[model samples]
Target: MEQVAVIGAGSWGTALAMVLANNQHNVNVWSHREDQVNEINHHHTNSKYLPDVKLPSNLVANADIQEAVENAKAILLVVPTKAIREVCRKLRPFINTNQTLIHASKGIEPETHKRISEMIEDELGEGVHDQLVVLSGPSHAEEVALKQPTTVTVSSYHLKSAEIAQDLFMNEHFRVYTNEDVVGVEIGGALKNIIALGAGISDGLGYGDNAKAALITRGLAEIARLGTQLNANPLTFAGLTGVGDLIVTCTSQHSRNWRAGNMLGRGYVLQDVLDQMGMVVEGVRTTKAAYQLSQKLNIPMPITEGLYELLFDEKDPKHVVDDLMNRGKTKELEDLSSFL
Candidate 1:
């Protein structure tokens, strides 16, 4: 069994740890909270983050950051995008040059407008291997922890990391695919959360499946537009991490991003919605970063732009929806622009 460390014992982190542990990896789940560590070891229940999912007995929890990083061949850094730097800095002290780091958190860093990989590159420096892999797709932590059938993608600038991650997470119930489109995979994973929030708002506003289906379809176009300009393979946007993730996050009740968006759709203020969710709503902050990135990249991302207006710019969601719908007509294509 390969030794793997999963830092940050949030739902996704814990779920991923479960994936590795089930795959027979000796996983050490690091948590800053002592109570969570105790709960994982003693009761096998992380009731707050993972709800009813019982952690495997083989998966142990550790409260020390150094221990988590030191005893690892591969590390899964599951902290939020904002806290990633701090966690990596903590890890830097104990990390060996040989470790393969897999970053599973999805969200773009604000202000700097960097994706998680960029943040890792900035914070970890050249001392770390480009063997950094990102895992993302339609898998929800809630279902994943329950060992549900899920599919996700692993991508790295270095293909080896993706292969290793593929082996670590793939199981009878969980399928893992490898991709070389790091930019497309990361952007699709991050950007879909924003669209999911928009989808949530549509649902919250009492819009039916027809409207949401329209939003989902149109949202993919905007994502494609930005992904294309960013030099990401447009076809990657049609794959699991792109369109698959968008559908899950935007349509599913288990999606925290979608749940947060639902609250916003029901007229809850941003702060209040965040407070109520008591969890990371990645889409809210991602909307801002993506909106800014679109402006800088000179690409139109009306969904992200509209979500930004709803969250911060005091624009009416209905009006934004109307604006999106009233735009000029275009040919229906599955973003096969490159092939065309």
Candidate 2:
């Protein structure tokens, strides 16, 4: 059995740790909070994150960063996007080039506009990029922790590295697939959160399924536009990380982004909604980064712009929806050319 370290004690990280332990890997979960570490070690449950889920007995928790990565064969970086750089810097001192680094967190860095893999490379040096892999799809942490059947995709520039990651995470209950389009996978995973927020807002506004179905469909188009502009494979968007991830995140109550957007449509301010949610709504930050990226790349993303206005400028949600409804006509396949 290989020793694997899962950085972060959040739901996703914990659920993934469970998967690793289930595979008979010696999984060490690192949490910043001492109480959480104790709870996982003694109680075998992370009440703050996965309350009802029982963690595997072999799974251990640590408060020390060095001990977490020490002698580990693979490191799963599952922290939030905002914390990715800081965590990478701290983790760099312990990580070696031999170990595989797989990141499941999704978001484009706001100012640098770097993808998570790029951010890891920037912080840890380019030598780590070849070993970097991304795992993403429609699977939710809640469902995965319950051992529900879930599927995800792992992508990297190196097919061999991607395959190694595929072997590490795949199990009977959890199925894994490999792809070479790192850009497309990351872009699809990150941007889908923005659409999830819109989905929640649509439902919150009581606009019914028609409005939401439109938002989801058009949302995929703009996502493809910007992703293709970045040289991501357009066909990747048609796979699990693309349409599959979008469908689950935008429609499920388990989505934090959707819940946050729902509150916005229910007339709550951004600050209040964030305060109540007490977790990082990646879409809120991703929306800003994606909006700026679209402007910089000259990509037309009306839905992103609308959400940006509603989120940052305090534009009324109803008015934003109205504007989206009345936008100028265009061909449905306008963005499809980018793929060709």
Candidate 3:
């Protein structure tokens, strides 16, 4: 059995641990909270995160950081995007360069606007990212914890690392695929939440599927436009992490982005929507980062600009929607020329 260390005890971390434990691997899940650690080891449940789902008895949580990291063959990181750098700093002193890092977080850093793998590379620069891989897609923690059917994509700069991740998580109920486009996978996974929030807002405004469909289609275009400039493969945005994640986040009841957007569409302020989310509303921060990056990169991202205005500048949602629909007419695939 492979001994793996998961560096967070949040819902996603726990769900992934369950996936490993079910495969009979020795999984060590680390948590900052003492009570969460106690609950996972003693009660076999992470009530605060995954309620009512019974975890495998063998999977457990560790409160000590060193104990969790020691001798682990592979490391699975599931912390929030904002905490990635700090977590890396903590892990740096303990990491053996050979240990592969499989990151499952989905959000960009606010100030650096860096993707999770970039943050990992920054934290441990010079070939550290060669051993890094990203696991992303539409699998929600709530459903995955129950062993529900979920499909995800694993990306690595190295094809071998991607293959390792594909073998690590793919199962009867959980299907996993490999992609060499780490940039595309990371970018697609990070930005879809921004669109999901917009989708939620559209739903909150009671707009029909026609609007939602248009938002997703156009959102993918804008995502590709910005991502291509950052060296991400254009087709990665067309696959599961790109289109698949977009479908789930923008449509599912399990999406925090959609929930927050619904509140925003109902006329709630950004702070209020965030305050009510309780969990991290990643889209809010992504919107800010993407908006700033688009300006810096000189990429024309009208949807991101509109979402930013609506979320922070008190722009009317209707007006934002109108502004988007009234933009200068262009061909369907003209924006994709950068990829060619």
Best-matching candidate per lDDT: 2
Model 2, runs deviating above 4 Å? none
Q: Name every residue pair that clashes in candidate 3.
A: none
Top TM-score model: 2
lDDT of each: 0.86, 0.94, 0.88
Q: Could you tell me which residue pairs clash in candidate 1?
A: none
What tens digits encode model 2's per-residue C-alpha lDDT throughout 46-109? 9877888889998999999999999999999999999999999899889998999999998999
Residue-level error in angstroms, candidate 3, position 144: 1.1
Off by over 4 Å in 1: 329-340
Higher-ranked by lDDT: 2 or 3: 2
Model 3 residue 9 CA deviation in Å: 1.5
Off by over 4 Å in 3: 336-340
Query: TM-score of each candidate?
Result: 0.96, 0.99, 0.96
Q: How displaced is residue 220 in candidate 3, in Å?
A: 0.5
Error of 1 at 233 (Å): 0.9
Tell me the tens digit of each residue's lDDT in model 1 across 1-340: 9999999999899999998998888999999999999999999888999877878888999999888766699999998887999988888778776788999999987788888988887878865647689999999888888778999999998888789889888999899999999889999999999888888889998999999998888788888888778788989988999899999988899988888888877878888988989888888788889988889878767778888888988687788888888877767764436323
